[model samples]
Target: MSILFGLLAVIIVLAIAYAMSNDRKNVNFIGIGVMLLAQVLTTWFMFMTPIGEAVINFISDIFNKLIEFGTEGVNFVLGGVTVEENASVFFFNVLLIIIFFSTILSVLTYLKVLPFIIKYLGWGNF
Candidate 1:
């Protein structure tokens, strides 16, 4: 049942792409196949390889540290509002962390680090 739905979704998306294409005859099937193969292999290695696992863990650790740092700042400014008894304040603090994350993202973008990473991930063209 899940597979049937997934196939249907793919068919619908392909149909949409075909309809939106301006020069369908100019499409390079070999290039599409190569890109698809690269995507599949990259996904497989990212999930299955030891080095990939280590890299994922490293990134997770960095993210957790950043979250902790943000929580500390929130606690200092909001003072007791983020306690377990104050659910609303805690939720607000979570939302506030987005500002900190976005600032960091903007700085990285300005430095071209993010664009380099995106290009490395095969999503640079956009």
Candidate 2:
């Protein structure tokens, strides 16, 4: 496992260096490759260990907190009435939830989270 991670780390760094010195197309491919590598490496490292259990718990806790926050916001704006008990209202609530999450995602990405993530993946320099 450690050897695998070490190799992945080396690949990521090399990819970033290549991206910096190569053509745009190669850089793009390198970026994609790095993302895939990061996904695989993280899966191998995190899911195959005891820490994986804690990581899962932490992720669940975060989602729970987000749900609680969303519920509070909805209640505040809708006078605390659970109108989504009806089918139409339920669909509307689902749409609202999707939109809320989408907007949050967009905002975070716009704030350069995506770029930072790519950088951390070590696929590209800038």
Candidate 3:
């Protein structure tokens, strides 16, 4: 069944991690367990809860707005080249959103918001 395959995949990944780890004696099982629990709970909530759906919808709306903003900038600079009847131009224009997201992420990193979460969550040690 699908569950068996999923379990196998997790085992394989953990085995690979164990093989690649430099300090094999210091494997933090508790941290791994906590992270796995968080992932499972988050997945369950995201798929099975109304509140999670609302949160996802809110984030999706924000992303759509950001993408629209990017498209506007692309249209301004490219002078409607992206709006032309060509798939290539449309694809190129879509990729412009990556630049927008990367800039936002870089700003968050500079402000130490991302690093703070990583440090406090023990993700840095992981």
Candidate 4:
């Protein structure tokens, strides 16, 4: 029942994209198919598997570690601050962590490591 609506929505979106594409002949249907399959499989793996719980925990641990690192950096700059009294704590915990993560990603991109990794993991080969 709900699946039918989901399929209809996907079809409509794809139809619109194809209709709007100027170079329709160059559209890679195989790549699109691969992407859809990958998306569905990844979602199923993340939701339906016990390994998903472990993956979630692992990611949580990484973020926790990154937060600790961010806190340490903030403390170095400000002497000390608590989340209760200072907005800087929140800024350091969230925004600085994001900036730090993005910097790491940017470095990886500059090194060409990200594209190499993404190509294999993503729809590039397909």
List where candidate 1 sits over 4 angstroms from the true fold. Answer: 1-11, 22-30, 83-93, 115-126
Predicted structure 1: lDDT: 0.78
> Tens digits of per-residue lDDT for model 2 on 73-116?
77787787766444577644666666667877898799999778
lDDT of each: 0.78, 0.74, 0.83, 0.83
For candidate 2, the TM-score is 0.51
Give a tens-digit lDDT track for model 3, residues 1-126. 998999899989999999999999999988898888888899899879999999999999998998888878777876876355555553566567787778878998999998998788775444
CA deviation > 4 Å runs, candidate 2:
1-48, 84-89, 122-126
Ordered from best to worst lDDT, the candidate numbers read 4, 3, 1, 2
Clashing pairs in 3: none
Candidate 3: Cα lDDT at 101:
79
TM-score of each: 0.65, 0.51, 0.77, 0.65
Expressed as tens digits, the lDDT of each residue in 1-126 for candidate 1 is 996997688669877887899999986767766766776698788789999888889999999999888777776777846355545564656676887788789999999999998888765332
lDDT of 3 at 118: 79
Alpha carbon deviation, residue 47, candidate 3 (Å):
1.0
